[model samples]
Target chain A: MAVKDTRAEDEQLNRFWYRYKKHTLSRSIVLQLMVCAVTIGIILTLYPQPTIDAWIVIGLVTAIAIVSTIVATSIAMRPVKDLSSALVHISGEPTDLTPPNINDSYYSRNKLRPLLKQIYAIASANITDAEAPKSSIALPNISGQLNHTSTGIVMMNQSKQIIFANSAAPISIDSNGVRSLDLIFDVDQPIMEWLSERGEHDIHAEKSWRRIPNKLAGESERRIFDIHVSYDRGSEAETIITMLDRTGEYQPEDDDLDFIAFAAHELRGPITVIRGYLDTLNDELIGVYDGDQEELFQRLIISANRLSGYVNNILNASRFDRRHLKIHLAEQQLADIYDVIADDMRMRAEAQQRLLSVSFPPNLPTIAADSNSMSEVLGNLIDNAIKYSNDGGSIEVSATVNGDFVEVAVTDYGIGMPPNVIANLFHKFYRSHRSRETVAGTGIGLYITKAIVESTGGKISVKSVEGHGSTFTVSLPIYATVADKLTKEQANNTSLIQHSSSGWIKNHGAFRG
Target chain B: MPIKNILIVEDDRFIGEMYVRSLNKAGYSVDWMVDGNDGLIAARNKPYDLMLLDVMLPERRGGEILQILRGGAQDLIPGTKVVVLTNFDQTEQARKDMEQYADGYLIKAEITPKKLLAFIEKLAASS
Candidate 1:
């Protein structure tokens, strides 16, 4: 019966192709005759005089051209007939489907060859009812590939019995032939809840949980997972749950920052002890040391201070990375902050044999800032200036009132950075190749400095020329203006300060230094 | 109202000893506790003019101790000024909560022995 049906289908395909070719040929011939008639008429009109012999020659040439055009059209369209037959055969029976061999020169030059080959390849690959058993052989291969995947897959039937689970799945069959999701996940887990709530409906749901403490034996660290659940509530009801472990993907960067914060915290105790003892010795043994010894002692203190600054930078940078850096803004005098650090700055500059001068305009406006963090910012810039300068060049620390803001510029006659280096100077861990060897730095000072300045409603910028010098400027909002804005915001019942600690300023009298 | 009697609640031996030596040499009697529980007990047993508290400590945290002493029905040390001295950085909210009970907050690494002594003396004179 199948053979007879195939023969009948082939005959029908041939009949269809013949009718298509005949119709296309008749249309082409009629179109050619019309063109010939129009050309002859145009010639008669243009010359207005044509002999009988010239007319006969024109008619003969036109007839030959028309025949040749018909032949060319037929040849060009032969590929279509071949393609249609191939498609009919492919659609008829899988067993009888044979892919067309397009290696022949005729087909190789035809534009439809690639398309014909693609259809034949697809038809041959398709499995019909007779070849359905062959697909069973592919089931293991698919399961194997799924097993190799990192995503855990669990498929369950309507009765809640796990039908299939990949090796990555956190499930196991019990001795009593019981397999359930509860064996792997807690009953109250969000995944379980999601499954129970949405498993009976046709839907797709996705959820992600972060830093879930590992409950497995002997494992102390947390794990992150992204879960996707797809359910089909048809006659063959089933639910597919996929879990992707994202712990390894997110751990390295987080671990690095945590380690930095931990290490910085640990370093602070030793730094405190060292600075304390050094200062104690300096206070007790004053005037006992000779000039050179006193200078050496002073250098020791300076180095200790620099160490403390480095630790602060590491801590702040780590905190900034975790989005945990806190700044408390209040009215602060720039001169008061400078006065506290003037001695240290002078000693640092003098130690380098470079003159350090600071100038602040009289009646300079007070700025809104966290005094401690602002001190760090200024210290970092000055330290950079002292570090990068060639011996004996001067460094200037100056502040100016620029409309409702104060711009504090630290300029140094140092080996300034090129534009390329200056562009990446504020990026974390970005060190210029030129200064990496000659200078000792963690490359995080400027980053932390910029973070602190900007977090307190300010901006930091740099101007540098490779051979000349670099000036780092910090612009901060004036206190009265910030206070005025804050008061207005408070009256409007809007939150003026983003940082929680800044709320202390509500009782402004207590913070008045 | 001189800060002659002081309480130093610090876990690190070296840091605690440094403060004790500096304050003692500066003519103030210093009581140093290495554990948070011991420090709280000492604060309750005797009155101190000033208390230098470390935030992270064994047995209990300085913040917890401060909350207990200050948030209780009775003020254990009415005139004692509490200062949080630690290297551990606090969040803004934590610092704000601490500022309510703390007279001062200072980073231990940022202040030298001499500076700390001077600061305590100033607090003493002001009080």
Candidate 2:
């Protein structure tokens, strides 16, 4: 819609220029001719009357005036004729505006072709619009060239006021209104400026908008859109944005899902038989075997565990993509949850020669969070930190309580991220270029973490430098029920600060109750 | 340990038969059932040293069967050890269920027949 509107505006500006140029040139020519005529008339009036020589000079002047008038009239009418035909074409009645038998070779081809194409498209588009007032025309819209399409389209002014919005946009905004776009769309201020400046330069931004806060009556809605923006050529002032509903696009291909399900179903049998064989071998219940056979059995066990992990990751990602991921919430201490996840991941961290450390202050304020979800979030972050960090690098987890909010920071001394990637750190399937080479990441961990954190009334943010390291801070609202335990003064003064000295342990102690 | 009766409870028939063959080749008598209900009935009808149970089974679930076996009816068998074999690993629910019943839980893809036999042998000896 914006694209079409912008194109129309462009045409109007073009017509204004066309008319302005013709008028200015004609006016200047007429002024020059008038001045010449006045001078000639003055000369004739001043001279003695009725001599033959004087009559000859007068005839010569009159002949010159007649030739100049014809030239001026023809020159002026040429553009006027072009304008008339252009206007007629624009108003739904198409006519051949390109003059017949005009020698195109006379015009400079290189300089004029682009301008001519622009003029032609603009003129033709308007003609189609006027011709078919009710019929759909092939003109660019927000999506670029919409022909009977239903995509949510929105246009906002500088004031953030939604001026021209489509019905789909309103439906998507739902009860939350345009205010929701402001909350979720986290493009940089400079990017917005760039969009405005470039006008129609395509931008690839991954924007995640929460499904409208309030639901439509009785519609069990579990849908969200991840819009990918690209530029479409239209006008210079307004941008052209294209959105792809990623939820619809990212659902695993049916073949993959079926394969996984079938494999899992088939795996049960062989595994059962394997377990039985292992039991027989260990018991010497079966025929005696050598140490090599026992070692092979051990290898089989390890392979199986690894395969299980892969299958689980695939299944989890599928659930998350489907938006069927759910978290069970309960009142819990941040430090305690950290301890559990840390312990669970400690062996893995040690096996990789990386250090994991955690810290939290005593008497720290409690937050209402689901322990399982929190564990998953922490595990993912810690795992990523371990993966990206150097072999002997150190990782730290700390918590600080700020009134109603508690901030949990996970800092890793690793190969940090670039500014480009730090901005899109939480986007799904978004991986840093550097990390892509060495690390095997699904790129959905941080996205899942962000979703889990936000769904529980908590927010996660990242701070990083390319070479130094990265710190991910999660801010969660302190549990409301526990607020009454502290007086106004104590509540204001209560703050928890913890620092980890080494791997998975805080010098300030594990957690403050 | 040389010659004994074993019961295999699994939803997939192919897997159940494979277990039966492997255990039978090991010189131990083996009984197989496709569902938890039939497995439980088999356990009641005959005495068995160990039972290999699949976690997700039709008619009755492995967890339900574990509860019944661990309940007052355990006097009927005197001493029966069950090991839960399942594929859903790393999940909190699966972990919780593993901790709840069975001597030990083994993910289906992770354990081999020989290693499984070792674990069962250990369980039998310890009992």
**Local lDDT at A212 for model 1:** 29
Q: Supply the DockQ value of model 2.
A: 0.16
* lDDT per residue as tens, model 1, B21-40: 98898898999999999999
DockQ for every model, please. 0.22, 0.16
**Model 2 lDDT on a 0 to 1 scale:** 0.57
Top candidate on DockQ is 1
> Quick one: best lDDT, which candidate?
1
Candidate 1 residue-wise lDDT, A1-513, digit = tens: 999778756645445666788888888989888888898899989988899898898889798978988899889777777787787676563333344567767677766778888877766555431233233333443466577576778877666578778877666468998875432231114555665676434444555433322233123444444566666543122567777777686556456756877888989999999989998998789979986999999999899988888888888887776567767666778987676667788889999998899999989988887777788899999999999998999999999999989999999988898898976787656689988999988778998899898888899999998888999999999999899765554454223222211122222221212
All candidates' TM-scores? 0.61, 0.48
Across all candidates, what is each one's fraction of true contacts kept?
0.52, 0.30
lDDT for each residue of candidate 2 in A369-429, tens digit (9 for 90 to 100): 6565676677778777888899899999888987678898989988888888887777656
**What does candidate 2 score in Cα RMSD to the true structure?**
16.6
